[model samples]
Target: MTCRIWGRISSINVRKVVFTAQLLDLTFERVDAGAAFGIVRTPQYQQRNPNSLVPLLEDGDFTLWESNVIVRYLCARHPERGLYPPELQARFDAERWMDWQQTTLNPAGREAFIQLIRTPAEQRNAQALAASVAATQPLLAMLDARLASRRFMAGDTLTMADIPIACEMHRWWGLPLEHAQHPNLRRWYDSIRSLPAASGALDVPLS
Candidate 1:
């Protein structure tokens, strides 16, 4: 049986899984959920993913949630694809960036996104927005330095690290901020943008 993904296209988390699936050439059906779609709270959906989050993966009898975990599973299942290396050290290196994204970048980015996108303009929290942007700069600088030295986050090869980070990067670049001097980050992002999967799955307007 074919795999199925439950999530809206506009969601960053869902975009990560969709992009990964596209990279692996895996055919899957995607169902809208979360925010505007109320299916996420349904009893059947709750049984599959109690968290009621976007990007739940259902492959045959197996089910999985968490976008990064889903990507890791897909890469592990298709080792020959080279998107997720089987080597322990290399995989660890890629995993490091993924962890960093979850722990460090996403929190900061989400705050900025919520203030700028989700919050009403009249009642938006400028102070909080400023703080979030300040917090994010150092992280972006770190990514810029890493990209300066290597073509991709996990060295020269594009691995799972690129997927999650790229999703965030789309938001970062799309936001109305003065262009910064992260040339390397910009170059790497542009390259990823050129990918067919990235274009199709990730190039959505920020919500």
Candidate 2:
């Protein structure tokens, strides 16, 4: 049976799972939920996920939420696909960047997305948007420097680490900020965008 993923595609968190599913070539039924779709608040959805978040994954009887965890679970389920390495250090290395995306990059870039995309021009907070852009540059510069040595986030091949950060990059790049030129980061992001999964998930119209 195909796994079930509950989330709206426009969500960056939901894109993480959608990208992962495509990367792993797993058949999944992505039920529209959350935001404009409106099923996330229902009693049934809350039962599956108390936090009532999108990108919930259900494989048979096993259910998981939190976007990164769902990505990790999918990678683990398809270890031979090499998205998540089995070696302790390699796996953790990938995990660290994934956490960094959730902890640092996503939060830092969010205001820019909200202000530029979601907020109408007059109502947007300039200071918050500026601060958000400033906060995101260093995080991206760190990634740029890291990619100066590696083709992808972890080392060479694409891994679970790249998915969330890449989606975050999509968000950042989609915005109209005066981008800090991180050549290597741009190169790496361009490479990731070429992936089959990326074309549909990360390269879509930001909404």
Candidate 3:
């Protein structure tokens, strides 16, 4: 069944779903309906997703939200992609990093993106921006340590975990912050940068 994915192209959350769909090579349609293109508040859209968030997925009659969950759903349709592992521990290993990106990485990482790119220089909060960058560094260090041997988040292969985290890294790296280098994280990112979906979506300027 063809899926209908809704979100603006520039949204990092939406990029996660887009990359997952492209990686799966699934038949789908993407509807622009968030941020400035505001269909998310429409009555019909709200009925489908009351949260009014971008990156909503509709597969036949099945609807899903939260970008990482949408990635999981799309991967389920094409098990051969190996992006979502079936084994319990392996699956959770992917899920764990996915959750950490949302709860830990994104929160800290978004600071510099917003302050430097979104906020005007005169209006920027220098202290909070610096603190946010500081908070995000050790988290990248954590992933660096994890990637010290493994080529990907879970193991040697790409999995659902890397989708959201990669978007987060793209945001962090794109900004002009004086970031502490995470060698292993940089190594993993360089390897994945060649993926068409990732190159097309995450390589864009931070917005």
TM-score of 2: 0.97
Cand. 1 Cα-lDDT: 0.89
Off by over 4 Å in 3: none
How displaced is residue 57 in candidate 1, in Å?
0.1
Model 1: runs farther than 4 Å from truth? none
TM-score of 3: 0.96
lDDT of 3: 0.87
Q: How far is candidate 2 from the true structure (C-alpha RMSD, Å)?
A: 0.9
User: Whose TM-score is higher: candidate 1's or candidate 3's?
Assistant: 1
TM-scores for all predictions: 0.97, 0.97, 0.96
Q: Mind giving the per-residue lDDT tens digits that candidate 3 earns over 63-161?
A: 888898888888877888888799999999899999989999999878888899999999999998988888888888899999998999999899988
Model 1 TM-score is: 0.97
Global lDDT scores for all candidate models: 0.89, 0.90, 0.87
Any residue pairs clashing in model 1, and if so which?
none
Count of steric clashes across candidates, in order: 0, 0, 0
The candidate scoring highest on lDDT is 2
Ranking by TM-score: 2, 1, 3
